[model samples]
Target: MADQLLLKVRTDFVERVTKPVISGLLDDLLDQKVLQLDEVDEVQDRYTVRADKARCLIDTVRLKGTKASQIFIDSLKKRDGTLAEQLGLVAQQGPPGDQLPPPEPSVGIQGQQQWIQQCSLSEYQRIRDKEGDQLPHKKDPLHPRTAESCLSLSSQIYPIHLPRETRTRRALIICNIEFEHLSWRKGAEADVGGMTELLEGLGYVVDIHCNLTSQGMAVVMKDFADRKEHCTSDSTFLVFMSHGVRAGLCGIESGDETTDILSLDTIYETFNNKNCRALLGKPKVVIIQSCRGGKVGSVLMSDSKDPAVPAPIATDSTPAGLEDDAMFEVHLESDFATLHSSTPDTASWRHPKKGSVFIQRLIEQFRNHACNSDLQEIFRKIQYSFGQFPRQLPSQERSTMLRKFYLFPGH
Candidate 1:
């Protein structure tokens, strides 16, 4: 009989929910001593169980459309009221069938005391108006508890909170246009203007640095990383535009010598958790607009007069730690992303008059979608835009990000 009851309930559960869910439920019921296996028939689906003393096996097995149609309704209500209510298996109170109890007439405070007593203190307070009259008790959509719950859930799901315009929004734009020996980049300065304008419009306090040597670049980056703004800000952007090779961006080394290359590894290490604790756990975006190599790409010209431009330059895990042989420490690192102008060993396109193809497309796409789309999606669109042309394809690298990062430009 117990086996028949278990088999019936299991069948109903599988039919209504899923086989996997029913399997879990069966295990839980067995573990909780609510049901015990009695016998297993030759058929895989047939099972027998011994129910608890309080639970009736006969009522628990019935699945017909009679008065006791729902099996385990009482047991489910006793085990998990919320789950029973969600599954619509809770037994109706008052009269049976589809008939519900008639609504009670409006009553005074004396008659409503029992219902008011069941409410939380804060909820009860909200029931009264400012004039102290007992107002109709309506649920508050913006209650403090509700807001806190939502925030808590969001934080758990998306650990990093992308900074808003109201917070400290800072961007560093380093454009090296003038080289002593090499021909000066024609449109490098224009790129700075466009980038700065776009960033500022998005509420960033843009700092532009022009024609810096390798040492100067390092100093500026270090200083910026240590800024108090980064400590308080939700996110930061570092944009570097100059000549470059596969190793890194080229800084001026005594005029035209490209010997002074600021290595990409060094840049990453500088902003890492250990060095730049101020920006820890916040999104750090690095945008580079420099050539990575000498390989140039072919362009398919359209009917439009715009000339096909040459490639312009471009531009963690958690672990446990022990201290003092007695204490254990844990550290987590995340939320860093880099957007490169082109793939490794490839030249990035630049327009001598307009700007680098990457930066131009970036600014346009950001303006169009920053308010609605995430940073990754916007970058993907920029890459798509370059697909029509030649040579310049953007690439992105990201560390562990708990949630999506969005600029929310113009917000």
Candidate 2:
């Protein structure tokens, strides 16, 4: 049931929003001797922080191999003054340990309180806002939660679809939101809703979701791996919208340390044939809206500056790729097709209303072209529209990766 899905989403929310604080607090306390070895051992003995810890590590993660150091710090700090002194000596002689000294006694105590409040407050508010006070655990959207699912940090990206008919292929739209909660992101909302409208009209069974976690996102793609099970036809479309750092998508959860975003590859690779079913050998289309680089080195427009409205550009339709044999070569046939509004080389684009520039352009074209031509033609048309969409002063760039996919007539 959809409510069960919502319950799963709630689990994700806890993992995303609250688990980090608990995990970090555990780390900070254990390192600072605030939490004794026995306490940690007891917690580990009962519940060793699996999902919660994994989520924290996934977000706070750095290069690699640092987690072990963190755990060592926790265990070492759990020991008495003698061990700390010995560890201090080891650190002085070798590498400094990764854990930060526990905050000043007063500060650590107060900070712990603050962390608990901050960690739980916003999520509770969000659940209350969505589910209401009386009916908190409304599992199905059809029936509101009787009590907001009390689970911490759990949330979902709702992707809805209607069963397909004979003429149309199945389509999936994935929208990722890096910033605000999924409910609050107007840009993501409109774009996903718009895609649903356009694709449904185009004779495709469209599946859509907004603001998914890395794991959740991967699961969505994996669901698409089976072409026969999910879709009646061979062709399909997939979309991704999110706040992204270069090469990655932001998970709703915070990092164990740095809070840097996770890579899109974390989710995208799920659709790879070795992993998924329905998506194998199908035309997989992906659209992304996120910054690709850090070095734009330019100031953003001031409050008084008039926004440059996006104007549609005019261009004749061209073939998907340039090479002659490339027409429908489907170069890595099982691979996916991607069209990113911002090059992995640039930062991000703007959308005060309907969503990211890439999604905005996608909706515009899908609305205009989905019904008339094949998915290949629709993509090319959308590509042209995006190339024409206006950007802020340091105009954002756009590009696509076909990865050996062909959406229309085969050569």
- The candidate scoring highest on lDDT is 1
What C-alpha RMSD separates each model from the true structure?
30.2, 20.3
TM-score winner: 1
Candidate 2 — which residues are off by over 4 angstroms?
1-164, 178-186, 226-228, 254-262, 294-335, 371-377, 386-411
TM-score of each: 0.53, 0.43
lDDT (Cα, tens digit) per residue for candidate 1, span 135-217? 22466766533432444323422233343423776788877766665446666655766786566556566665666677778
Q: How would you encode candidate 2's per-residue C-alpha lDDT over 1-411 as one tens digit per residue? A: 111112122233333334434555456656655456775553344333454343223222211123433443444334333433443412323334423443222111122322111223454344434433333443676765433244332222111233322344667766553333322233454565555544443445555544556666666666655546444455456666555555466555423343435555554555555555555555556656555443332243111101221222233455665562543334323445566655434555544454555565666655444323434455667666655534421222221232222221110
Error of 2 at 352 (Å): 2.4
